[model samples]
Target: MTAPPAFPAPHPSPLDLGGRTALVTGAAGGIGRACALRLADAGAKVRAVDRDAGGLEALAEEAHGLAGAVEPHVLDLTDLDAAELAAVGTDVLVNNAGLQLVRPIEEFPPDAFHTVLTVMLEAPFRLIRGALPHMYGQGWGRIVNVSSVHGLRASAYKSAYVAAKHGLEGLSKTAALEGAPHGVTSNCVNPAYVRTPLVERQIADQARTHGIPEERVLSEVLLQDSAVKRLIEPEEVAEAVAYLCGPQASFVTGTSLVLDGGWTAH
Candidate 1:
């Protein structure tokens, strides 16, 4: 109900999500942890969702004394119904939880594919579906999907992860188009390989698949196309997420904010 600080100043103002409710998935660590803290710093009540209860507890401790609070919700996204239920009444949604399985398509297990698609794609749809009603009633919402470079570029032995991300990109665009009329915005933040446990696990899987040592995964596989040649830190990705949820990115719907460090440029 109050006007945001006047912009066009020498330095842009920090985001202020005072009195808002934000839900961040995979909030136990990595980019999700960073995003949760960033939003809490902006004064949003952050519902931190992840299956790792201990990690969530640690996150709660770390978030102590922020402008907002962290409420942990331990649930695996595989439960589509519960995932939707957990999203009800949230003003902002950050769909960051995901999994990866590196193997040739022929070798990719059907169950793993289904699990990846369920968590990374279908659950997000459910959360968006549940959150939309409240958001539409309020006439404002922010939906940020944490996609990956695989969404735009394909690589061998990452069939499940790539497929899910590509689908998420499409879903985000569709949400943007539909939400625009109601003042809700949807966008995807596509980052290249990030230094998270997920990516670290991928390193070992990739080594096994490619028959190369784990040490070469970073230089040869992950950062091969990234001109920056470094694994993006989770905080960097979180900063981008914060920008999208801020007043400045209101007009930035139906777009993929590519933080791939020039991977797609090649």
Candidate 2:
């Protein structure tokens, strides 16, 4: 077999992914949507997968006229076998589908906890398992896990979310070690309070749980630990994902690219 062509100077800069195919879970909205669009902008054919069929349609509509195509794939990550099948043959994988239930340990439902781990942790493993053979065959691939600051630090009323993300971090690292020789890189992007439907939905829950008004949740709860004093944009996190999938990050593996705005500094 012939060797791959040499990457252009300033590799992955100018971030061209033309002819590549990327699969992004939870691609209906928020950071997932942003990542799908960003990858498509970089000329990658994107498989936008989500449980929300309408949202997927909207995402595909918005992706019109991009450098590459957006193919809508309606999938519920809870379906482990289907999730794995959805990932096959992709050159890039962004594991971003997640769910959150903010309640103290005692109040957290057992089923909810299981669902969190299944969607956030186990599904990623299966997706990676599904994507690996094709990636290994070509001797190149990228896996970017959308972890959270919770992955590294504990947070109140977030037992399930925290546990799942922490597990994802470990999974990402293990994949990195195994994928190294095959030219595949696995990494996590840790963000704090991204401005997405997930975070917006949490505001009211946080207010009620913390005995504060919804308006104050942003300052007193969400951004309190972040030195930047603001919510991060979905697009910003997507950019980091793109960078990881780029040629410049080939040597970057088994690590978390944190975009927490100093949340972990405390």
Candidate 3:
């Protein structure tokens, strides 16, 4: 066989988020905060939304020195009316707000299950539906859903989380199909356990559930599936979110970009 030349690597597009407005839910926390910062750094006016007013304010303060401005909003995604969310005038919508509940399916509390579903799945759907009119009118928009590797695979004692993430993926796919003709894109970044307060809380729960030490739960349970054998960094996921929101990803939609560090490779 004849030798073939190697393909050149593609370069990233220059930052050009100027004149754009992005609304990021859960912007007060780990991955969400990173995403907000990245978007602002790329010159997009960022509307940082979270239930925690203090954290949102902190984020806004941090972003004030960046290329773009941050507007903090203490909005509870679960309780917000559709019209209210639409009024934010978002060009890119990141449905990043989520909660984790760990319990065996048999022992899972009904209220807890419903709450998780409401926040993770239902809230994103409603936000997208509400934001569509604005995006459609502009004829350009991006919707990035921060999902989890659990959306692709299941684990013990995570019935509600898995179900909600799986449902979110389905919803994103359907939205992509519908938004295609409108010059809008919908996709997801499904990451494995990131080293965040959320995952820290899950560590304690996992330790309690398995009757194992927290260290063991982290090393053997949470990171067991990944070939990297380490928790993913929040900034790594944030970078992926930014790429999806950028101009280069115009044709990418209805896809789940897994940041699982080879967890799903097996």
Candidate 4:
């Protein structure tokens, strides 16, 4: 049999995001804020959206000193409209807005469950649908969804949060396949317990649930399943998001980048 012909090596892309715009929902705090700052530092204009006007303004102020501009919007992702999103004209979209509720399925309120689903899963779907037109027109775009380790595995008292995150990952994978023809990529970052305000709140909830002291919750609950003893930092998750949005990641899509310090390794 004849040997197969050698394949040609691919050339590197020349697209540096010097003037590109990125829309980051929940950009006022935690991993979202870190991502906005890092993208701005890399020369991408950032449109920071959050329900908290004061927090959004703070992010914009901090980003003003970076290489790119930051535009703050006090918009709630739960009530976002396509027209308003299109007006921002973003080259990249980061769906990071989410809420966590800790309650057994039996005790979970209908309204709260719906609220979590809307913010975590439904809103991301809507944003992706709205953003695709611009991405197709430009023939280049990136979508990064901030999922969680819970997306893959489950625990008690987080039925709504876990379900939404798992759904978000599936949605991202589907979007990636659809966006491939338009040079757009979609992926999710699944981080372990990060020391953000969200996780801090969970600590309290977990302590209450287990009848343990708050100080022992991290060691006994959050870090117990991981090989690493420490909680993840928001900046670490931000780094993963940056990589997914960079030119180097052009071929990486329809995947979940897990930053769990080996939490899921087992």
Q: What TM-score do all the candidates reach, one by one?
A: 0.95, 0.94, 0.92, 0.91
Per-residue lDDT of model 4, residues 22-81, tens digit only: 888888998889888888877888888788899988888888777787888777767847
RMSD of each: 6.8, 8.0, 6.8, 9.5
99-200: candidate 2 lDDT, tens digit per residue: 888898899999999999999999999999999999999999999999999999999999999999999999999999999999999999999988788987
Task: Give the Cα RMSD of candidate 4.
Answer: 9.5
Better of 1 and 3 by TM-score: 1
True lDDT of residue 175, candidate 4:
95
* Model 3 poorest ten-residue lDDT run: 1-10
Write the residue-wise lDDT of candidate 3 on 1-266 in tens digits.
11123223223345678899988888898889988988898899988888899998888888877889888878776685842464346888888888887888899999999988988898888888878888899899899999999999999999989999999999999999999999999999999988777987787788888888776887678878988767777778888888898778899999999999898999
Q: CA lDDT, every prediction? A: 0.90, 0.91, 0.84, 0.83
Q: What is the lDDT of residue 237 in candidate 2?
A: 86
Candidate 4 ranges beyond 4 A from true positions: 1-15, 82-88
Model 4 clash count equals 0
Q: How many residue pairs clash in each candidate?
A: 0, 0, 0, 0
Runs in model 2 lying further than 4 Å from the true structure:
1-13
lDDT for model 3 = 0.84
